[model samples]
Target: MKIKTGRRVASALGGAALALGITLGTAGTANAWTADWETVDDGHGVGIYNGPSSTSGKHGFHDLYTPDEVYLICWIRGEDIANQGNVWYRTSEVYYYRIGSYNLWGNYYVYGAYVDNYYAFHHRLDECKS
Candidate 1:
């Protein structure tokens, strides 16, 4: 009977350890960036803008290299490009760029045309409050 009790205790401890590990693992992932990273399909690179419109001289602060993955925070309806719709995704992560002698990094907006066509579907992205 003593040997059986010892085995039961060990089994219980192992189960507890497993549960703790799972909890910790999930917690670790939760701390990571919550947005999905998508690749920019444009081979020539795409411009990262302050606003959704490319025609806006105030926007397009930096250029995001093509085939790079960007963390999209949300979406908004703005100027249409290449007849690809007016959808745009706002990025949450900073990108590095050089302007003349200075290097700069900032978060910016990307047109949906640079991303997959699937993103054009309605409700595919969380709309930005702005």
Candidate 2:
């Protein structure tokens, strides 16, 4: 199929825009988060981080990102797909806890952690009065 000149231009522009968006989205400060811990045995264990310590300072001093209404959040970080563990696989239960003197600041983050067998964890329902 022959695309018109205008259509071709628009298509090219759209593709370019999409590519730019993808690049910008992934681009960020290096070491944005602290590698508090990483799996020693192949990616089976897991990697723990206090907060993003990138040059951008994305996570600031918080331990994790609180849900929109103070609820569930992805408070854990893994190296790659191999390390991205879920609430299964007979692994340690990652629980984010408060650390440092930033107690009253909110969003304690994933710290003061250890290891425990976890089956699953999903609390979509929050204490919202909706």
Report backbone clashes per prediction.
0, 9
Task: List candidate 1 stretches off by more than 4 Å.
Answer: 1-34, 42-44, 57-62, 94-105, 118-124
RMSD of each: 15.7, 18.5
Question: TM-score of predicted model 2?
Answer: 0.18
For candidate 2, the lDDT comes to: 0.24
Candidate 2 clashes between residue pairs 3 or more apart in a chain or in different chains: 31-53, 31-54, 32-52, 32-53, 32-54, 33-52, 33-53, 63-109, 64-109
TM-score for every candidate vs. truth?
Answer: 0.54, 0.18
Give candidate 2 regions above 4 Å deviation.
Answer: 1-58, 62-81, 84-100, 104-130
Q: Write the per-residue lDDT of candidate 1 for residues 2-34, one digit (tens) a residue.
A: 544543454344335434543211211111222
Error of 1 at 117 (Å): 2.8
What TM-score does prediction 1 earn?
Answer: 0.54
